[model samples]
Target: MPITTNGIHHEERGSGDRTIVLLPGFGCSIACWAEIAPLLDGYRTILMDLPGHAGSVGAHADGDLPTLAETVYDACREIGLTRFIVAGLSLGGAISMRIALDHPDEVEAVLGIMPWNAGGTSAGDPVIEGFNAAYGDIETITAGITSISNDPTKTTDLLHTMPTVTEKMWRGWLGGGAFTSMADKLPGLRVPAFYLVGGKDFVVNQAKQIDDVRSIPGGRLVLHADLGHLACYEEPELVAREMLNFLDTHAIAPA
Candidate 1:
């Protein structure tokens, strides 16, 4: 059953004492977890729709990233998620960083997947450009499709998601200081964190992500070979496997 807490819509699945919260990237719906949810075995999974996206569209706000994370924490508390792991992609990743940083005791681990700094308004901003292209109009949207993936078959799935996106979602990501700028706080994240990136993610600087994670104490970084920004979307099987591996090492306390 779907539940709402603090205006955030989320659903839980799987079965285990430990929980894993899955957060989608920018402009994505809660369905973003469709590919990976079933694969996460032995843990209760919370599939959440970020504020201002999909079912939670009404929850859009002008607050900064930490504020958003606080709202997420409120939802977790309401749902009885006292202790859990967080896995996020892109914009979700930045929010996850804030959550873990603020509540290291409650967040057992953090799985940051292709999470980049969601702050900037430069004309050359690839992320903003991609969004504008996808939602701006017909010609740009068509041109933006192939930029996400090389596979023709996979392109169709991403294309279908464009309509669900909104102007609020755009502001939350591209607007200045929408997120608390995870880039500088990388080294301060005390929770066990796993940073996953792809070789082909053009929007985010992959090298910087790797360097940021390494600077954190015992932070682990993995690069998905031949993949792009949406690794969770493009390679769910590998993402699930890698996520489980990270959970085993960090989330599950050693006996």
Candidate 2:
């Protein structure tokens, strides 16, 4: 794992034909992608822990979406990744969207999994708030995440390696100011994109969000009826396979 001054922790694997940057959701560390990354062994995968999460707990910034996007961009630059597919879940998905909109030259494509549109309410807001209230209380926070996670055992194992996050970071996660503002910028984004959602997700309307994304030329949507908010974890192998297929359709060059 490599660490950046801005408090981003990342692990890289399989220097293959394509570079796939994986970003986790709010309060989640890079380990969230543990099951998913290995499945992408034929491709280069970079799993990143956003600031204020995991080993990067003290990492600080404006804590807004744009700043988060820049932080990701900086992390990629620090590691010499200029062009790659940026895939994100939940909050990470929103950040990926911002990156695609603001720095199209650096991002070849975006995979947004259970992404929250800034204009809508998050389905798991109550759960997130309750967890944040117990930020330093590791047990409480862990329990909260497990309740929402598709696989409690795997998620708990991953969380055990990280320190408790702060209330500020939690606030940043819930604040959709950055995501909501992104609607205005979407029209300008030309990158090939994939919008994925779990059919059971109640945090946001999958169909509506997909409709919004489809307004963009070449945008595609995928919905898994058996999954929910944490679809990547619930179906890592399937998601990884679908991701590779999407990339192939989009013609993303291998690294």
Name the top TM-score candidate.
1
| Model 1 regions lying over 4 Å from their true place | 1-5, 117-123, 130-139, 155-157, 178-180
**With candidate 1 superimposed using the best TM-score fit, by how many Å does residue 181's alpha carbon deviate from the native?**
2.3
> Residue by residue across 1-255, what tens digits does model 2's lDDT show?
579766778888777867999998766677668888888767899998877777667677445777878887888889889888899988788888888888888888988888866344544467545754665677876666667666665566446643355557666655533334566666677788888878777555676677657666777887788767776666788878878788887746645
lDDT of 1 by residue, 7-77 (tens): 78898778887888988877666666788988988888999877767766667544357766777778888
Provide the clashing-pair count of each candidate structure: 0, 5
Q: Give the alpha-carbon lDDT of every model.
A: 0.73, 0.74
Worst 10 residues of 1 by lDDT: 116-125
Candidate 2's C-alpha runs over 4 A off are 118-134, 137-143, 158-163, 175-179
Compute the lDDT for candidate 2.
0.74
